[model samples]
Target: MHLEETETMHRKITDGVYYVGVDDHHTALFENLWPLPFGVSYNSYLVVDDKIAVIDTVKNIFTQEWLDNIREIVDPEKIDYIVLNHMEPDHTGALPKIAELAKNATIVFTQKAAGMEESFYNVGLKTKVVEDLEELSLGKKTLKFVHVQFVHWPETMATYLAEDEVLFSCDAFGSFGALNGKHFDDEIDMRMIESESKRYLSTIITSYFKFVQRAIEKVKGLGVGIKFIAPSHGPIYRKDPTWVIDHFDKWSSPELDKHVTIIFGSMYGYNLRLAHTLKKELVELGVEVKIHNISYSTMDNVITDAVRAGVIVLGTPTYDAFPFPKIWAFVNEMEGKRFQKRPIALFGTHGWGGGGVRKLKKYLEENKFEILEPNVRCRATPTEEERQAIKTLAKNIAEIVK
Candidate 1:
């Protein structure tokens, strides 16, 4: 009801439902989910009934408040199950503390989640492994587990309540904004929630669209009413479950447009000028082009463009005879994710030996990318001749897309 109340963690949703979305002050590298915007909340839920069940737990830093929230509803010892829908640290960081609180409760998760629990926490606790479509009865309500692997992690899952038609969707169908004394989906501005939700999904869950689509299809087939979708982040999707599900459907489809993304790091502004010239030439040739400065652009945004673009062009000014650090890191991350089957080109302005283009080309080749022939590279500054060469290369990129 009050924003200050949510500061200490509050509860909402149905009469039997409660939530403890703990504030996480992670910064730069840790706090942001996937894309690293430096703010987020690790949501945990307490489903009160004849046999109480805690849907998920928060990060270790918020364990005390997490327990206090549980204590407010019912004694921790009375909790019958701790349903683990995901094993990521933000969601499972307080497993040890939660295990201590719910001493008699069994940790309900998929077999993969059970295996991951050992890696997450060193605590010894009893775990009850469930497979796809496995149902666990909790007095009047029954929770069904559906394995949703590779949405982000192999151990991820979603829990459904048969009687209430509520879905405990962990990490799926979630947003980034912290709750402001409102827990249900309908209470928040749908436009703001949808925008944040799209950003979060595009940054974190873009790569695993196939698996996410499969999970969505499986859930749809269950014929559950799905009146509410209580994800483990942001606001709960109680008002419009279909809104999030439809978003996943559209994002996961392979019907995106053709475009070119040029990511580069320029120290002296010469390389940036070349990138801009190339973008202009490409657009003149009737190609949609998006350019990003590696130092300022987020890799998540790059990845999102990469998924929809037909070509990826990397430009970098040589730094100690190698590509720029951000450019190198970007390539390494994309390579590790096995991002392939796209045409790639390299361009750069180097002062001395001009090694950046060669090094980037080798890296893209090793990463199994279809290297476009005759990449554009300029030494020091581009002359009119070199500018013409870049324009030609842009045309080549457009031709490849066509």
Candidate 2:
């Protein structure tokens, strides 16, 4: 692995393709909402084929570094193509600079993504519009375009290298973590990959649940013979390309895990007790459980935990005749996820009347959840009867989740 003066590392992905991406540890947030505590990588690829095509561009903040990396493998001026699989800013930030260096390179992207790219940068680079299953030949390698719409963005697409059996997935199957000099999944420890991938999907791809499934099916149906997956983020899957796709298929499906996520908000600690009680019951019933206090935890983390659960438990304390403000906001955000039909249990404490539980129940029903029978609600503290009801609620949830 030879490095340039700027420490530019251009790794050979295959005989013809090279990894020319850079890690972004300075960006505090992804999309300005999801936290990037572990940092992320803005991946780009260099396809050294007949005409020297660059797969994608990096962020503008690393323009010089990116250009240096490109210069390491091939003359920037010799590059003839710049492919845009998605129109997202992170992937297109260096377009203007790159176009300047690779002066004669033609910008290539889907017909649908062309408008967005033009509107995004308005750089007058000669362009080539490709369609789904469209083939672009670069001497020895044949690049096939697979249109995967709404995998997160409206015009998002993926590029497949036919000869190499490598799928350069733009954002699909991407995780939010820097590569730390490693170029392939086979080279990195995968203990954290699953969680980070789940976090990325839950935060970025979950909203497009049906679209995700459709895109996966559309690509799989093509039978392009994928053996490597080079997503725009995270480690490239070389040993097993379908590895991330298989994970995406299961995540997007209707099937839920035999696990429960309990989210609770408490002002006087009574609501938290109910959450713990429910967790204990679920654990005793041989069900996996994770409890989180929404007040301190970010929504991204909570969403990741909730994505595959067989059951969801929402606990809150009544405040001003309604559910706690934070909990209500979190639950309201979750309301948009109407595709999930998992069993739900609402248990909370109200000081005077049962306003919190009533409002939460309405919200859950509005979101089209299959609410578990016998919800637990108590005034101030749990009475003997209320405790018995809580037990019943837990038992009913166990039956449905386990």
What RMSD does each model have against the real structure?
2.7, 1.8
TM-score for every candidate vs. truth? 0.89, 0.95
Top-TM-score candidate index: 2
RMSD of 1: 2.7
TM-score of 2: 0.95
lDDT score at residue 117, model 2, on the 0-100 scale: 78
Candidate 2 lDDT, tens digit per residue, 167-267?
89888989988887876888877777887888898888887888889988888898668888999999999887777899888887878888889999998
- Show the lowest summed lDDT stretch of 10 residues, model 2: 1-10
- Tell me how many clashing residue pairs each candidate has: 0, 0
